[model samples]
Target: MTITVGEIKYTNAFPFFYYVDRNKLLEKDCHFLIQTPATLNREMKAGRIQVGPISSFAYAENVDEFVLMPNLSVSANGPVGSIFLYTKRPLEELEGSRIALTTTSATSVHLLKILLKQYVEVNVTYDEMDPSFDEMMQDHDGCLLIGDEAIVTSWREEVETYRYDLGELWKEYTGTSMTFAVFAVRKDAIARQRAILEELYTAFVLSKEKNRKEQYASMIRHIQKGMGGTTAFWNHYFSNLVYDFHTQQQKGLLLFYEKAYEEGFLPKPIESIKIWGDVRTHHSSLM
Candidate 1:
């Protein structure tokens, strides 16, 4: 049987899929496809892709259909280079402000809304805007950008922008490590191809180690070719973007889901979201 794996074209997700594609790590029948986060979520929801990295919100939104793998996630504590809230006014001062959102990033957008409602206690308007930072900054009170677009820009000087780092905000509010994205496999897929999934997980662990030691050169090369940015920019991103497969971060994720539930962002409270394998015994190669 063939497994269609959906992966996001982001630096954090690169190490997970890159090694498999480059080395042909899977069985001959198994295949993978690289896609944007939105596309990945769509395909996964439709049961088209058997396994992949996906938005945290997608997993939360469809918790019944998938199970998390041990020791793999896209997360950072202070500043996740790819996800940011750019605004002319401070988050606290943005009362009745119109915030522009990138339609592609459901996780960040929902996160921003939850934060604003909880902390700011302000009623704000949300509108879909162009993904371009400059364009969104022109009309909206603030804009949320993700992926390569957020990485390349100088938000500090370019515009009168108040940066709200979502990851940092989450840490402050929850007192737990934040998990932005996770490696999840469909229930049916895991049941049918347990061995293949285990092998894929092992490959990810190996690649994570090699990626850390080598400063993610191969992943960087792939991103740089598509995203026009300086080495310094990419360096800052790589340095800050952490790849850790730890069960410890589960606390933060649970808290996020709790808050989302309280705020009515999720339809119901998820009692528990467990990692598939034994996290205690799984040794990650991430250095």
Candidate 2:
């Protein structure tokens, strides 16, 4: 079975996909489609690809069709450096302000909305545009940015702006971590591709273990060569993230879905999250 994998083309996602056992996939080729989170979300939803890390909000949109892979997610406890809101005014004063939401991610966009409406209690106008910091700032009071673009641009230090890290803010308001992306497989594809998917899932688990232990240094170095951040900075950045999706992460995700629904952004309330595996996690792996 030729399996198609959607890879989120972001520095924060590299650890989980970098060390896959491609040569061991039952002699079938593994095709990779590396793109932004929004694109992967669409591709997975359309069944064009078997599995990938999709925006958390996108998964909630079509939860019935996707079964989450065990213990795999792009999540963070606090201060995820890659998702930021650069504003000229304070959070309290941003009511009725035009905010530029990045088109590259659905989860971040919705997360921002949840934060603003539910937590901050401010209603702001949102405009979706490409993640261009300069152009976005021209017409909006603030702009939301995520993934590599936000990572590379240190808007907090370079400019005199009010910077908010969504992850940190979520923790402050909700008192829990936030999950941005999840690894999911189409529910229909489960019966046919079970073996291959199990192997792939194990490989991903091993990769996350190895990376979290000592392998991420190399990833950070490579990202530095291309993305241009100090090794220390990159280390600090990735340290804030958690790859394994366990009970806490699931609760956080459900809370997000709840907020999205309450804010009228999510279509319906999701009572529970569905995982492919029976257990919550394969918790320990070379940690």
- Top model by TM-score, which number? 2
Task: Count backbone clashes in candidate 1.
Answer: 1
lDDT of 2: 0.85
**Per-residue C-alpha lDDT of model 1 across residues 133-218, encoded as one tens digit per residue:** 88887788888888766766653364656777787777676566677788888988877887667767777777777788888777
Q: Quick one: RMSD of model 1?
A: 3.3
lDDT of 2 by residue, 1-287 (tens): 67888889998889986677555543566677899999998898888899888998998998989989888999998888899999999999999999999999999999999899889999999999999898999999999999988976673376778889999999999999899999988988778876666666777887888889994987787777786877788788888889989999999999999989987887789999988865233432222
CA error at residue 34 for candidate 2, angstroms: 0.3
- Model 1 lDDT, full chain set: 0.76
What is the TM-score of each predicted model, taking all chains together?
0.88, 0.93
